[model samples]
Target: MFANPMILFIQVMNSLSLAMNLFIIAAGLTLIFGVLRIVNFAHGAFYMVGAYVALSILRVTGDSNLGFLLGVLGAGALMGAMAFVVERGLLSRLYDKEHMLQLLFTFALVLVIKDLVKMIWGSGQYSIGAPPFLRGAVNLGISPYPKYALFLCVMGPIIAVAIWFFMERTRWGRILRAAREDRVMLNALGTDVKLVYSGVFVTGAALAAMGGALAAPRSAVDPGMDSLVIIDAFIIVIIGGLGSLLGSFVGALILGFLTVMGSIYLKEWVIVASYVMMVVILLVRPWGLFGKADEERH
Candidate 1:
């Protein structure tokens, strides 16, 4: 199957697109885990909700780049605001509680958000056509490839760089990193740890939502979509190493390539192939490819 150059090129491009999408979502998951020490099970729910919200926005604005941009921004802002509420009203109370409680609370949030989505959007699958400028295909010497997929290929890295710059260059980003190192010490310096935590959670949620909104134009928006992406995001995070942004990017790329290739070669066993790879990698390096062993403390 790899003998065909055109087929290989298209699959490679597709994998790149997939890797970037997974990175965006998994990056948020890792960031939340890194700072708040909470495994947000509802991250996927936010992703799903973003897609639905984007779809609604697109319906109102029609087929234009501005419409897509609004959809993505609106979805992110909405999810971020919702995250603020969740962090303040519920998650705030659980900080001193057992890890189990945090897990259960977030898991419960998954169900609540899913049901709420069902109520609002029903169970139907919806899709948005690519913006006019992105609707066609690009000639890649071998054959034509989707312009939107190419756009996604570029978008992933742009987002990653932006995130890196934000974390590395900004004062709030420095505070966030400091909080990750030691919240108690950060608080002692008169920084509002609570506010920082809330901000981190909201930002992470917004990134997940933005990822979903961006993906909506490429795939169908439907019920249970959150479940699917969440599983993939978890796999990426685990493989990349919890709390490591670089790990998330590398892990996403590995999984994306494996999944795309496995679908072509292993057929129905593609998922098993991914897990097998994970197991093998874990056996070799328990903390993941770029993850540090000491970062596991909660």
Candidate 2:
């Protein structure tokens, strides 16, 4: 499998594209976990909903560049709005509760959102075509590769840089970091912790939705798609360190490479390969590659 140069190049390109999509989804989950300390099982539902919403928008508007743009943005905005309501109405009430209760609440949300999606979109598969400009293959040294896949390769790094700048350079991003470190202290300083939490949750949800919208053109949008993506997101989060953005990027890339390569060279061991990598990584670094060990609380 490794002998053919063109084949090897295509596999690398495929891995990079997959990694970017995983990074986008996992980034949001990590952010939510880092700040809110809540394991949001419903996050995958948000992704599924985003895809459906974007597909619906595209269908109505026709598959033009404008339609594609609107569909993705609209999906993100709608999911964000839904997240705002959920945070205010449900999650806000659970901040002081036991972790188990919080987990259960989020798990319940998964079912609710799934049912809502079923009611709206029904139990069927859907998909959208790539934009006209991104429809064909481009020659890249070794061979021609799908233009959309190449676009994804470029898009991922652009998003990663944007996220890094937001977290390190923006005032709101600084506040979020501060809130994650010490919510009580931030609150005592007159920052509205509740509002911050809501904002963070919405932002995270919006990112997941945007990822879903981007993926819609490439894959089938189906009822169980949420569970599949969410499982991968969880694996990425665990491997990358629960709350580290850099970790998410690294983890996604590693897993993406392993998964794609395994499928080609070790077909039967593809799934096992990823888990083995995760296990080995965890054993070597219990706190994840970039994750810090939590300080003890008295």
* TM-score of each prediction: 0.95, 0.97
The best candidate in terms of TM-score: 2
lDDT of 2 at 14: 95
Clashes of 2: 0
> Compared to the true structure, candidate 1 yields what TM-score?
0.95
Tens digits of lDDT, candidate 2, 1-298:
5788888899999999999988988888999988999988888998998899999999899989999999989999999999999999989999999999999998999999999999999999988889888999999977999999888888888888888898889998899989989999999999999999999899899989989999888899999999999988988888898888999999999888988987888899897887887788889987778777776221
Q: RMSD for each model, in Å, please?
A: 1.7, 1.4
Q: Pick the candidate with the highest lDDT.
A: 1
Report every candidate's CA lDDT.
Answer: 0.90, 0.90
Q: Please, what are the lDDT tens digits per residue for candidate 1 over residues 84-121?
A: 99999999999989999999999999999999999999
Deviating ranges (above 4 Å) for candidate 2: 296-298
